[model samples]
Target: MLPIQPSPRRKAIAAWFQDRLAWDSVREFIAHKTVPVHSGTIWYAFGGITLFLFVIQVVTGILLLVYYRPTPSEAYESVQFIVTRVAFGWLIRSIHIWSANLLILSAFVHMISVAFLHAYRKPRELVWLSGIVLLALALGFGFSGYLLPWNTISFFATKVGTDMATFIPWMGSTVGRYLRGGDAVGGATLTRFFGFHVAVLPALTSLFLLFHLGLVQKFGISTPPWVEKRSRGAGTRPPQMPFFPDFFLHELMVWYGALALLGILAAVFPWELGQKADAFASAPAGIRPEWYFLAPFYTLKLIPGHVAGMEGEVVGLLGFGLLAFWWAALPFWGARPDGTVRSKLVTGGAVAFLAYLSTFSLLGYLR
Candidate 1:
C-alpha cells in the first residue's frame, strides 16, 4: 500500500504558508544575485566559514547546556559526569570548544581581508562596524564560557581578567565588580558569566548578525580596488557566477572540510576538565587567559612597575585603549574621494601591530 499523503486541509495550510512567506520574491532575489569570480573569490568564503562555525557552536552549546550546572559547587561535577558518562557527550563538548576558537579565528581573517581589500568604504561602513561588534561578542563568549567549567585555570584567569578591568579610567572598580559580581571570582561570577554565555551574548549576536546581513544584501559584495580598476580600464564588467548554485556550492565544500577537521580535532584531543576551582586555595603557577587575551596579558606583566609615576597596569591599559580606539574608528579615518586608505603608513602600522601581537602572545605562552 502507498503511504498516505497529506489531507486536503493540511495541503491548504501548506499552500497558505508558501503564499504568506512570499517564496516567489525570495526566489527572484536569488535568481538576480551573482558571485564575482576572481583571485579574491576564496576570501569571500571566509564569511561563510565563520557562519558555519557559529552554527556548530549553537548546536553543541545547547546539548552541553542540557547537562551543565551553573552553581560553583556543582558546575564542575556536572561537566565531569557529562563527559565521562553521557553518550557522545565528550565529542559534543570538544567540538564546542574547538569550534568556538575557530570561529574567532575565521572572523579575524575575514575582517583583515576586508581591510586589505578596502571593503569598508562609504556604504559598507556599517557592515564593518557590525562585524567588529560580532568579534567582540565572540570574545565575550570565550571569556564567559571559560568560567563555566569552574576549573582551576579558568578561576585564576577570570580573576586576572576582571582585575585588569579595574584599570579603566573612571568606572574601573565599578566595572570589575560588575563583571565579577563581588570583590573576586566566586559563585556569583560563575552564575553571571553563565548567564551572559548562554543567554545575553547569543541574543545580542543574533540581532547584530541580522543587521549586518541586511546591509550586505542592500549594498552587495564589494570588488577589490585592483579588480575594479582593471575592469574599468577594460571597459567591461567583471565575470560573475550565479550565487545560488555556484557560490553556495563552494561554501558547502568549505563547510564540509571544516567539519572534517573539527571531527579529527575533537577525537584526537578531547577537552579535559582541570581541578575544580578553589576560591581560598592557591592558584597554580603559569595560569593564563585564553590565547586571544595573551598579548594584552603579557603586556601588562612586562610593563615597568612605574611609568612616569603612573601604575604599570594603568599605563598599559591606556595604551591598549588608544590602540582599540584607532581600530574602532577605522571606517571614518582617512576618508577620501574614494574613501579608501591610500597611505603606506596605515598598512605598515597594521603589519607592525600583527607582529607585536604575535611576539607578545608567543612570549606569554612560553612564560
Candidate 2:
C-alpha cells in the first residue's frame, strides 16, 4: 500500500491549529476562577442533566430519521416500520421521546431554581435569557414533531394549534395561512414543520447553547441563596479549583445519572402511536398536548372571552401580547439585584397557576 501522508504545508497548518487550541490563554479563559468547591446539591445537577438529554435527543432523532417519513400517506407506516422492523429502532425512538420530555422538565426546574436564587441578575442576565429562548425552542420542537406522526390525534392537535395562530390580529391570519401553507393544514404545512423540527430549530439551538455556555464561563456560576460571601471575609480570596478536571467532572456524573433516569422512563413507557389518522374522524375525547404544553393549553382555556372588541379570540391575542411584552422586558427586569417585587408577583402567580394546571391535567389522565 502507498504511504499515507500530508504535505509539509498541510502538516505545518495542522500543528498551528493544534497549538492554538492547546494555548494556555484559552485554558485560562475557560477555567477562569471556576472551583470544585462543591455544594453537593442534587438540584444543581438539573442544568447539566438537561443539556445531556438534549444531546441524546438529537442523536436518537437522527437515527430514527433513517426510517421515518414525513408525508401524510407514509408517515404512520414509516414509524411502524421503525418500531417493528428495524433493529433496536423501538429503543431509539423511545429514547428520543423520553429524552425530549426529560430535557424540558429539567430545563424548567433549572429555570425556576435560577429565578428563585436571583441568579439572573446583572452579569447573568444574558445566560437566563438564552435559557428562556432554549426552553421556547424546545417546546416548538415538540409542537412541530407532534404533527409528523400524521395520526388522528396529531392531526387535530395541529389543526387546533394553527387555528389559534389566526387569532393574532391582522398579521395572525396571514401568518397562520403561511404556516398552514394554505387555508388548512396539509402537505406544505407538514413539509415546513418537518423541516423546522429536524433542521432549523436544532441549528438555532446549538448557537444559543454556545452563547449560553460562553456567558456562563464569563460569569461564574451563581452561588445558592444560603451561601454568601464565598469565603471568610468580603475581601479574602475564595477557595478555588480548575474547571477542566473538577467542576466539569461533576457535570459528567450528573449527565450519566440523567441518562440512567431517561433509560428507566423509556423502558417503562415507550411512546405509542395513536390510531392512523382519520381526516374525517371526530376529534378524540380529552385531547391534550404533551406535558410541557399543558400549562399553556390550560392558560388558553382559562382566559376570559372578552378583551378589546373581539370575543372568542381577543383574550388569546391579549395574552400573547403580554407574553411578548414580558420577553422584551426580561433583560431589564432581570437587571435588578432584587428581581423586582412585580417580577416576584408575576413569577409566583405563574408557578402557582402551572402547578394547579398540572394537577388538573394529571387528574384528567387518571380519569
Candidate 3:
C-alpha cells in the first residue's frame, strides 16, 4: 500500500514551525525519556498535582483580581461583590482558596514522599533544596493572600503573625516592618500583602520551580534504594515506562481527579467572606492563622511568656529555626559517606515531624 503524504500547505506550515521553534527536539526527548515504574512511582504524581493546583490558582486569582481592590477601604466590599454579584465568582474564589490549600498540602506530600523514597540523595541535592524553597514560597503565598479580603479574622491573624516575626532576633523587626509596610497592619499592610501574593511570590516561585524541574529532568527519576537493591539481588533491571504516553497519561488522570475534588469542595462549601476588618475593634477570641501555620501557632501558645529570662516567643522561634535548618539540609545529613542513606533515622524523624504537625494543627483548630 502507498503511504499518505502531507499536502503542500500542511508541509509548508510544518516546515515553518520546525524552523522557528525546533519542537522536534522536544518531541525526541519525550519519546526517549522514561519513568521508573515501581510502588513509589505514584508518589511522583503529587509534584505534578501541586503544579496543576498552582496553575489553577493563577487563573482564578487573575479572574478575582479584575474586581479586587487592594485597599482596606474597598477590599472587603470588593470581595463581597465578587461573591454575590459576579457570575460564578463565588465558585471561582472558592476554587482559588481551596486550590491554594491543596497546593500546599500536595507540596508537603511530595516532600514527604521524596524523603521516604530517598529521592534526595547525592546528585539531586539541588533538586531537594529548590523544592524546599518552592514550598516556602507556597507558604508565603498563603500567608500573604489570607489577608486580601481584609476581613476581621484575617486582620487579627495577620497582626498576630507579624507580631511573631518580631521575635526573630536581629532581622525580626525589619521583616515585620517590611511585611506591614509600617509598625502595624493597616491599609499599607493590605496593599503590601496584595503585591506579595500577586507579584513577588509568583515571580520567585516561577524561578525556583523551573530550576527544580530542570534538575529533575537532568537527573531523571531516582529509584528507591529498596527497589534498586531488589533488582540487583534478582539480577534484573528496574522496570520503566515511557514518559510520553504511559506515565504522562497516568499523571493526567491524577490531575483530573484533583480537579474533580476541587470542584466538589468549592461548590459544596463556598469560601467565606467574613466581616470587614475594624481596626479599632478588639481582636476576636480564638482567631487563628491558616491550618498550615496552626502547628507553630499552637506551640507558641503553649510556651510560657518568659523562658529563662528570654521571651518564650523568641525561644520558640529559635527552636523552629533549628528544626527548619535540619529539614532543609536533609540531603547532607541523611546520607552517609559511603553513599548509603540513614533510612531508619530519616524515616523516624519524618514520622515524628508529621505527628507533631498533625496533632498541633488539630489542637489549634479545636481550641
Candidate 4:
C-alpha cells in the first residue's frame, strides 16, 4: 500500500498542538528534576502523600456521586443503598472516608515538618502560604463532606460548626446564613454543603495546588538547617537524587504503604450511615464535631460565659482567629533561611499547644 499522506487539516491541527504544549520542554524539565538527599528527606514524602490521598478522594468521590443524592429526604437512603446494594459501593465509600481523614493527617504532618525546617523562609513564603491555604481547603472539604449524608451526627456537627460563624465580629449572622443557604441546617444547608464539598472546595483546592506545586518546583525542597550549614561549611551543596526514577519510586512505596493502611482502617471500621437526620429532634447530648475540630470545639466549651465584657463565645472566636492568623503569618517574621524564632521557643510553643489541645479534648470527651 502507498504511504498515507497527511491531510492539510491534520497537518495544521498537529502544528497547533505542537506550538501550544511544548511536550519536549516538559519532558526535559521532568528528567532534570532532583530531590535533595538528607536524613530528614523522608519527611518530604508527607507532602506527596497528602497529594496522593487527595487523588484517591477525587476518584472515589466521583464514583460515590453516582449513588449519592443531595436532597435531605433522599440523602441517607441513597447512601444506604450504596453500602448495601451497589456493587463494591461500600468499598468505594469507605475508601473515600478513610482517605479524606488520612489526607488531613498527612497535610498536618507536612505542615509541622515544614515549620520545623523553616521551609517557609525567604523566597518560599508564598509556597508556605499556598500550602496553608490548601490545608484550610482540605479541612473545608472535611467539614462540608461530613454533612452530605444528612445523618444524625453530621446534622448536629454541621449545626455546631455553622454556629461558630455567628460569633464573628460584624458579619457573623450574615456569613452563617450564607453558609446554610438560609437560617438553619436543613435541606438548604445540606444542598449547600454538598455543592461545596464536591464542587466549590475542590475547585479552590485545585487552583491553590497548582500555585503551590509550581512554587515548590521553582524553589525546590528546603534543606534542613543542619544539613545546609554543614554543606556550606564544606563548600558544597547537599547531594541530590534524580526525581524521575529513584525518588519517584520511593514515593510510590510510601504511597503503597499508606494505601494499605487506609484499606485496613476502612475494612475494620467501615463508615456507618448513622440514624437518618431529624432536624426537628433535639441534638443528642455529647455530640461533637469531627476529630480535627474537637480541639477547637472543646476549647470553646471550656471558656467561661464571659471574658472581658465580651460574650465568651465571641471572645473565644476572636482568640482562635488571632491564633490562626499568627501561625499562618509565621513565615513573614523576617526569619532567615535557617532560623526564625529561637529553637527552644518554637519547640516550647509547639509543646504547649499540643498539651492544651490534648487536655481540652480529653475533658471534652469526659464531659
Q: Which number leads on lDDT?
A: 3
Residue 290 local lDDT, model 2 = 80
Which tens-of-lDDT digit does each residue in 130-219 have in candidate 1?
999999999999999999999999999899889989999899999999999999889999999999999999999999999998998888
What is the lDDT for 177 in model 4? 98
Q: Which consecutive 10 residues in model 3 have the weakest lDDT in total?
A: 282-291
Best by TM-score: 3
TM-score of candidate 3 versus the correct structure, residues matched by position: 0.97
* Model 3: residues with Cα > 4 Å off, grouped in runs: 1-8
lDDT (C-alpha, whole model) for all candidates: 0.89, 0.77, 0.94, 0.87
Ranking by lDDT: 3, 1, 4, 2
Residue-by-residue lDDT tens digits, candidate 2, 58-118: 8999898899888888988999898889988888988888888888888888877776565
Task: Residues 179-293, candidate 3: write the lDDT tens digits.
Answer: 8999999999999999999999999999998999999989998999999999999999998899989999999999999999999999998999878999999987878888999
State each candidate's clash count: 0, 1, 0, 0
TM-score of each: 0.94, 0.84, 0.97, 0.91
Better of 2 and 3 by TM-score: 3
TM accuracy, model 2: 0.84
In model 2, which residue pairs have backbone atoms overlapping below 3 Å?
35-241
